[model samples]
Structures are given as structure tokens and as C-alpha cells.
Target: MSDSKYAFEPAQFKVICVPGDGRCLFRSVAHGACLRLGKPSPSENLQKELADELRAKVADELVKRRKDTEWFLEGDFDTYVQQIRKPHVWGGEPELLMASHVLQMPITVFMRDHKSGSLLTIAEYGQDYGREDPIRVLYHGFGHYDALDFHPSGAKSKLFQK
Candidate 1:
């Protein structure tokens, strides 16, 4: 049985669903992070590149700390690096950090637990970032994402009809 038994009431909000390819996490992060960029970013590919760079920075830091690349990755570090640089692979906290840095805004990820009936922030950047509105994303899990739009009552959006 799936642990995702409970769910948010669909009628209460609009859920923007993105592609479920291996890159969904990065794409969602990119959308939220780009809102405060002052101008639009060229594409999702650029944000993916930013995430790859962030991971590379982490690898460099680990090397500086004398940790072998294998400690945090598999096979050859260079190959792994190349793989992540391309699209489709998932990115986690490191990418979030990079997105936060690149956008100069805080990112708040809210993760919901149907089992426990709760929701909370899974990641956050400090308040020092200059932007007015923080970029926020709803993190469904390691593999998927979702967004809720609070439409006015009695207005049924055709896009999200049950």
C-alpha cells in the first residue's frame, strides 16, 4: 500500500503539476527560484546547470576536506560529475542551496506526511537574503512535486476539475 493515503483537498486549491521525468525536482525548484530573479531566466536548462555547479562545489569542498570523491559518489568522480551536469537526474539539498544563492532569496520547501497528518519545511535559507518574497515550493517527496492554488469559492477551474 502507498503511504500517501491522505491528500490535500483538491477543490480547495489549484495544483500545478509538472512533468514526472527524473528532473521534476530540479524543474520545480527552478520555477520557484526564478520568480525573484528580477528578470526571467532563459530556461530550465540553465537552472539545471546551476544545480550541477552547486554539486560540483560540494565535491570540491569535500576534496579540500580530504574526503575521497567515492565517499559521496560512485565510480569515477569525473563521470559522476558529467552525469549530473546533464539533465534527468534528481537534485537535493545542494541544488536548493545553489538556487537560493543564484536567486538571492530564501527557499522554503513544505513536505506533507499523509501518515502523520502533518506538513512542515524540509529546507530553508536564512532571512538575510535581500528579496522581498521568498521562493517557496511544495515538496511531495524525493521523486515528485505539487502546488496548490487557492481559487475563490464556487469557481470551478476547468484545469483542475475532479
Candidate 2:
């Protein structure tokens, strides 16, 4: 992706691709959680396990915050939560928001600008948790999400330098 709109070279960030199974969103978030904590990336098997664990937590979070979330949900809130608890179910924006609450950390989502070929910040969650050192994830605009982390050089882009 081009970095023309920002002050960092593209090489400073690396995308950690996860399996495109229906749990991609959760997998991406799990991977990002590791990076946010300055921990080494988890192995593929561990990533899947973490994703499933996170999916369960997110479901509980949605239920716990039902008063705030149910209104915007599409179907029976109970059913939605039950389905989301399953391992292979897919998650979208709603789940992403709930993830922020569950993890109590900020998540920054980026999407590739199709026309400009640059990455754009499409959505951010968990501002109350603070904006520093957010977990970054890239949305493919299809049905996939991937984790984005700093390269070994530990460089901070101007966009993120604050």
C-alpha cells in the first residue's frame, strides 16, 4: 500500500495475515492484541485458539451490554449472541465494537483506499480506553481482516507519532 498520505514508509508496517476462516475478524484482533502487548506473534494454532476464546468473550460482552447494543442488532439479541459464540461464525462492525469493550483497549481499523491505493482509517473503537498504542487491523473491504504491526526496527509513523 502507498504511504503518500502519511509520513511513514510502507516498509515500517507489516501485515500479519491470518486464516480466512469465518473467524478472521477475531483472529486479526487476537493477533493484534499480542503486538499491542509487545509480545511475540502467536503460532497459527495458538492464534486460532485465541480467536475462539475472544469470540466467546465478545459474545458475553455483547450480552452484558445488551441495553446499549441490542437496539442496533439485526435479529433476536439472544440468538445473535448465541450464534456469535460459535467458533466458525463471522463477525463484523458490531463485534469489533464489542471487542474493544472486552479487551478494554483501542482498536484502529484501516481499509485500503481503492481509488488512491493508500490505507485509510476506516473506524476506531475503544476511545475511552485511551488512544495510545492501539491494536491495528486492516480490513480488506471483502470479508477479511488482518493484523498490522511495526517492523523489527520499531519505527513509528508520523501518523501514529502523536
Candidate 3:
């Protein structure tokens, strides 16, 4: 908040707004993953690539675990699998769950709190079982998704500033 440590380095908290063009969720996930992986200011192309990779990876895992399909998809697992691989489709909490499972990481969503002028922890995606030393991603979730970042500097991050 106003502390020198926070002022000089803000890696523990940050934000990134993704395009609200229906592809925000995937873009958010991709960017978040990249940030977690230590790639500061990951490119749009790289985010898309990461999202697509996660989609395919999660989809395949679902297909293999037939029993898990009933919880995530509606009618057909095959159809769901194909759709998730597409760039245009949006992902939701279900996708996040699968992504966390596939990657074995924790995804923390920081929702904007207009009243409090701070973020509210809506949900975290790695509570299933136990995972030690997990990579973490911060997300902004409204009706859409946005990737959040942290900067270890006093100034704001140019790549993620509003």
C-alpha cells in the first residue's frame, strides 16, 4: 500500500486487462501462465499459444478420464474437446479447474471491489488434493477474464498499466 517495500517492488500484486473480444479468458490464462513462468510482458502471440496449448492438454486429459466429462461439458465430450481447442471460444471456471489440474498449479482470481477499492478473492483453483511448490497465476474475473501481473519496482509496469 504506501510502504517502501511495496513501492519499490510490487511482485506480490498487479493487474493486466485483456481484450474483451470473447477470447479474454484464454488470453488471460495464457498471459497468467507466462507471468507465473517468469516471462515478464509476454507477447499476445505467446499468450495465445499458451492458452491453446493448455486447452488441448486439458481436453485430452478430460477425454482420457471419461467420468470427469460429465461435470464439465453438456452434451458431447468430443464436441467440447474440439471447441476448447478453438481460439474464439471462451473458457470458464471449469476450464480453469482443468487447467490447474493439468498444470498442477494454483490460480488465484482477484476480483475488483469497487466499494473497497481493492481486490476480493473470489476463488482459487488448486485446492483439489495437494500440490507443493506450485506456480501461481493471478486473474481478474468479471463476466470476462483478464491477466494480472506483479512488478518488482517502484514504478508501474508499462506492459500492464491501465
Number of backbone-clashing residue pairs for each candidate, in the order shown: 1, 0, 0
37-145 per-residue lDDT for model 2 (tens digits):
8889999999999999999999999999999999999999999998988888889988999999999999888876667545677788898999887888888888888
Alpha carbon deviation, residue 66, candidate 2 (Å):
0.4
Model 2 TM-score? 0.86
Off by over 4 Å in 2: 1-9, 151-162
For model 1, the local distance difference test gives 0.52
Sliding window of 10 residues with minimal summed lDDT for model 1: 1-10
- Best-fitting candidate, measured by lDDT? 2
Residue 146 CA displacement from its true place in model 1, Å = 3.7
Could you give the candidate ranking by lDDT, starting with the highest? Answer: 2, 3, 1
lDDT of every model, 2 decimals = 0.52, 0.82, 0.62
lDDT of 3 by residue, 1-162 (tens): 011111112233556766776567667777776667677766777766666677777777677766865665776777877887776777777777777778666765555555644455566677553544233334444467777665445355344346
Best by TM-score: 2
In model 1, what are the clashing residue pairs, if there are any? 14-149
